[model samples]
Target: MDTCKNCGKPLENPDQELCPACRAVENAKARTRREEKAGHARRRRMNRTTRKMLIAVCVLAVVFTGLCVTATVMYDKYNPDEFIASVDAALEAGDARALKNLLKGEDLTVSDEGAAALCRAFTDAAQREALRGQLEDQVVDGGAQGAFPALGVEKESVFFGYSRYSLTVHSVRLLLSSPVQNLRLSLDGVPRTGEQTADGILYQNLFPGLYTCTVTGTTAAGQAVEGDATDLALLSSVEPTVFSGALPIADITVSGCVNDGAVITVDGAAVEQKPVNGVVTLPQVAVGSTIGMQYTAPWGAVTTASVQFADKTVTTLAFENPVTEGGVPAAGELNTLLTAHYAAYLDALNNQDTALISGCTEEYKAALAQGVVSDTHKANLYVMGTAECNPAAIKSTAADGTARVSCYVKLTYTHSDRESHEETPATAYRVYTFTWADGWKVSASADSTEEAYNTASMDALP
Candidate 1:
């Protein structure tokens, strides 16, 4: 007997490769493979047709895209709005060459001079940032307004019902005086415009209000000239403001112990300052007017002072910190108080007043009671002469205006049992920490450190 090759079924004929049941299964598998091969050929034909259609569609799409880009470039070249937008993009990017390409007219040629002008127009980082902000807003809203005038683009519209107005300012020279040049004008405490001629300065489209105009310039001999014609009113278009002035400003110096980041306001307007170093000197104060000032300290304390012009041209002002609320005296006043306190302290020591000695530092009191000033030791000690203590110097003050006062004390002392009437003259340097609460008092620290003299123990000596 023989077996089928696939299923191991017995066959009657030993020469057969498979039994009848296995042979039928092999025939079905062969037919299925043939059908599959036909189906794959049909799919390949369909795929080839689809790929050709896709390639044709892609080619048309690319052509359409190129046509659209070309149309846009042509439109932008002819359209004024699009042209101005191109110029703005160039200026915003600080591309002088691109801006020169866009700036072309019969009167304006793309030359070295034209390129230099364009560069200067967009060289200012602040002005470029302003233009970029304007461009971004226009792009977002699809609106056309606030065009770049330096590129010869006019604003499309101006919003009405606003407080916009115009004013012309000029400097006048007296008969014997030379002309002023490069005069810069500040409006409402901000630098607005600069005009070189003495004819007048024009500020157009400004909000109508009472603006403080300060003019500054240098004379022919390079002498500085500055003055303020403040509070010039611009009521309406019909009643426009025209301000003129001669530069005879009174130089005023403002100095004080204001906090590092403090702000100074003059005549109720906060002046624009860049990193003030605690003192602000105003070179353009108007004469014949009382100047009201307010200082804002870094710790949120505010104090105000006024300067009267009737006094003198050059004036100095020292501002006091209102945070302490008059509890802390000024520096000079504090020095005087410290000197008096040192004298009183010395007098107490000379008279051997234990009460005053106890009123000093806690460390001083402890040292006095345990050491030389003990009751057991007091009887043996004798002060052969008077004690003299004088405040020699006041050190740098703390943030709260407290300071350490150094004093030099002279004293002569001896023991009562000594046979000779000779005295010991001793000189000691003492430092007293002075702080303010309701009044100035000597601050105390431990006496273990030898940083300052132990005044309490010394005072206890006879």
Candidate 2:
């Protein structure tokens, strides 16, 4: 019997290698193997396609992430709100370096004190709100330019239609002045060289901000002095800002003085120090203060007129000795005698009597006598009243026993004629020459011009 070799099944036919069922089983097994190999090839092709698809997906994901990051960065850099927030942070922190980095300008700098002051100024709620509004308006509508004209907003384009915005600042002019000349100035610990002008010291291209100004100079007395002004705001570009301070002490030279006997008085207070070599170094006396000198003369003490203290200038306090070698009367005695002489002269004219003219010299008496006689011949009786003389009108006194005096006479007189008698009032300015003959006597009298009267009146002393 032929047995099936594969499965040991019985064979019906002879000379068969295997049973029929066994052969069928082998054929089915072979078909199954071919199908499995084809399936495996299909699976390998599918896996390669899947791997390529995965790689493309990963590449797309990475690209999408990069684009997202770039978009976010552009948005933050160009966003007005974000820009403003950065500035607000810097100001709140009072970080001068950060603020300077955020600003865009040529040759711009910020000092720590200046930045701190700026931060303080913006710390107010209302001011911060106003600033925010102004910055926003400047960025959006281009309005509010005048609010901070020196400051502005600039924009630049980046990738993918994005923009970067920055704040631009410009410099302004600062003008400083002081009564102290030759002043060396510094701002924010930095030495500043300035141009001298008629108005003041001009500093150009200075940043607009608060500054600590320091001034140093030598006074008129050759003493070093220093002064400082804090929080000096110079935030305008349209007009120059000015700062003036009084810091210099002035020395006054009292020339024409005989010795150091003159006492210096400033603003009515006598100084303890006296003049040395006619030079008075008034360290405590400020410029523009009133200063005067008082000296004791041979006859009396005299005070010079008060003058405004100027830097390194000479003021003459010349005291002319009123008393000379001759027996000239003192100024006070001469003034009194001249006043009385004018009174007697008016009385003599009114009474038509030469006896009352005893104060006049013999030559003047003869002249007055002739005038009285001439008036009597004309039938004009001149009756005079009230005469006054100003003692300050003494022009000068000479060692030759002669003195010039100006008299202002107010007279009320009755001019009686045969036709009519009239009471008349008259004012006269007369210059008289008085000679010391035994005593003070009026030697000559003449009507004075108005100009001469004014000059003599102005020359009079108090």
Candidate 3:
């Protein structure tokens, strides 16, 4: 085993049975493993290349999509401007279809400035209508008289001013009307205005120091036109003082929330409210007047609405129904009277009004004093089918020397659906105390919760 006994041949034992031939085979096997490793590495590199190509294609797709979106947004923004230009071209060329297409997107806004401007621009309704379409389609952008606000004028001026020579020379920026339409001349603090004319010359012969004048007349289609007061002295000129008028104030009010036993006052006048989100509504405010209001909440917590102003020219007092132990005053009274009250309330709801239930003398007096009913208010009482007030439980005594009675009257209010736009059939409790002459007045009661009150309407029930 250790050496070749004859011819120097290498010897192998039983455990090492292979010869040189077998050794060569083992070497070839090692070569095969190396070749397989190289092939695996090549495949890995190929896979990486494939992944990069996929990524590149996706990036290109994203870029293409982004460009498409940008193009769409640009198209929408410019379409309206393009339409306006087309309308102008059609007017010049007498192309009816082009004008008709442009008119389709109009949203009508009948401004006085627009009416005046139209009158100036066109001779008849057809011409005016076409321009009206233009005005309606106009936008606030596009430089005042552009697009949505299309009362276009290039130059506008108002000739007036203080002493020396009160006057203003208007350097128009976005004015678009040709010679401008609907010329109006209003002088501030002055009793009279200059004659109406397309030519912007106002002549006032009054002795002048320095005075502010506002020439406000609108264009024909009704766009507002202002002429800056140019100071005109008989022999000199001063810069005109400018003043801007605000829309008139019509009404204003103050309101707040409260618990029990809190009083509300408006400008020192006592206003009444029931506990639970108490709101005080003021009546008869002049348009354009900035109103001041102060509210004292429960426990002396207070809120004051700042100089609140309105512009709609007229304002009136609006009262939300006083919250009662039975929520609203109407639904709390008689269970037996529910059918009658329900019908009356239903009729009122149908007509968009409130129903008045009780008409008894004592209750009437209480209602009147409490401001529940007034002479100007039309009363709609509930007609009783079978419902009755337990007269025995409620006894009246006089008050203010009229004699009286005071007792707790439980008023359970309920409301149900469409037949009942308000007043859900759900029961709420109220305490009613009657005095001899005052009939039934609220003494002590549970909070007429308004949280679920909006849901109490008959219109909401099944």
Candidate 4:
């Protein structure tokens, strides 16, 4: 028996190649292989069909794209005049969206509101007619060049006449010159509140009609100011309505022995003061404004003046002048003698000569004793050489025959401690008071404490 080249069971019949189960299994395997082969052939046929369909689609797409591009080019080239005519029609009719569509550029992105504003900016009918004529001229001259002549809606600002609708809704606005703080404004007997801007306050959205506008505010000094525009028609929104009026002010001029460029203050508020040829003039000063002046002279001589402001013409205020003594020695001769005395006084103080200042005021003598000898003694310091005094100016003698003069004194001396030595330079502004007692004598008193400056590096004495 031929053993089936399968399961090792003996063949039932000679012709039977394998056992029943093995024959059945082999037959099923062959059938399965044939079905798999048929499926592969069907898939291949379907793949060929799909590939042919894709090729057809791609070819159609290319043809369609080419046709579209050709159509666009032909339309732009031949029908550009027709397109421009349509745009002119749209602009003349104030059609924003239509105009936007006609104007083309990569940079253009006009919103509905922008287009409307652009159209309304041109209020003249003549401008619109002229613009249309210009467009027609371009189209005629272009002929074969295909020149659409850039509408430039994005680059240029085209203003056409306003539509009748915008004219109906236009409103009047009032602009104030100066913004009054905490302001109250009323229009047409109705309180219309508004906020302040940098230049002024703007009242917006007002109907174009007859109205009365009033603005009121309180000044910093508790004075009430009110201004009003009466029987105002406010017909046109084209022109700005500027409201400005006068405020109560006082004018004053300050002149005296004070130096130029003096600071002038009004009611404790610093006013911008400028001097022309050494005179300060306050052109506009508020009523009841407190006025004051301050400036520094050479040698640290500071003069100050203050006065109350009244509403009137330019009021002149004179500063209090310094007093000086007059005798047989003229003012110039007296100044010369005073200069010599001041020089001697400084020299004696440097040498610790108490006898030289015996005629000086008690206050000055005491200051010299304590500030000079006593202070230096405690610090183990000794000053050498005569001090230099340069007279700057001499004021006229007062009714009391008392005069005040300014001097710049540079005192250079060798400062010595018990251990080492150093050359010290000192500068001071000294104001001397002299009362004629026979000859010019150094009065013990000065107008103010003499300002002394010393650059000597020494330990702080008592």
Using all chains and alpha carbons, the TM-scores for the candidates as numbered come to 0.25, 0.47, 0.18, 0.30
Judging by TM-score, tell me the better candidate of 1 and 2. Answer: 2
Positional deviation of residue 279's Cα in model 3 after best superposition, in angstroms: 76
The candidate that achieves the highest lDDT relative to the unseen native structure = 2
**Residue pairs with clashing backbones, model 1:** 169-201, 382-462, 383-462
- What TM-score does candidate 1 get on C-alpha atoms? 0.25
Least well predicted 10-residue stretch by lDDT in candidate 3: 162-171
Looking at model 2, the pairs that clash are none
Task: Score each candidate by Cα lDDT.
Answer: 0.48, 0.63, 0.37, 0.51
What's the residue-level lDDT of 398 in candidate 1? 39
Candidate 1 residue-wise lDDT, 1-462, digit = tens: 498888888888999989999899899999999999999999999988799898999999999999888767655545445644665577567665776564443222354443444455455567656655554555434444433422222223323311211111112111112245566777656776533334465554443223456777763334455764655544233322455544664556666634445455554555554225656665555444344445443322354555554434456655544332223234455445545544444444445565555334555545443343335543443443443433333332335433333333343344453455455554334444554433455554222222333333433212
Worst 10 residues of 2 by lDDT: 316-325
lDDT of 2 by residue, 306-401 (tens): 466655344333334322233434556654665566566656666667678777789888888866545653655455444434454654444322
Please tell me which model should have the higher TM-score, number 1 or number 4.
4
Report how far residue 197 has shifted in candidate 3, in Å.
Answer: 11
Which 10-residue window in model 4 sums to the lowest lDDT?
160-169
Regions of candidate 3 where Cα sits further than 4 Å from its true position: 1-43, 81-125, 128-192, 195-462
CA lDDT for candidate 3: 0.37
Error of 2 at 74 (Å): 2.3
Candidate 4 per-residue C-alpha lDDT over 1-462 given as tens digits, one digit per residue, 9 for 90 to 100: 667767877776878778899989889999999999999999999988799898999999999999888777655544545555665566567876875555432323445643544354323466456555655554445222211122222222222321111111245567665433456666645777665777677776554434566767655433455654554444345554666423454356766634456666766666667655556677645566666666643223345677766645547755555222232234455445555555555556566665665545555666666554554544344343443333333332322223333333343444455465554554333444454444445554333223331321112110
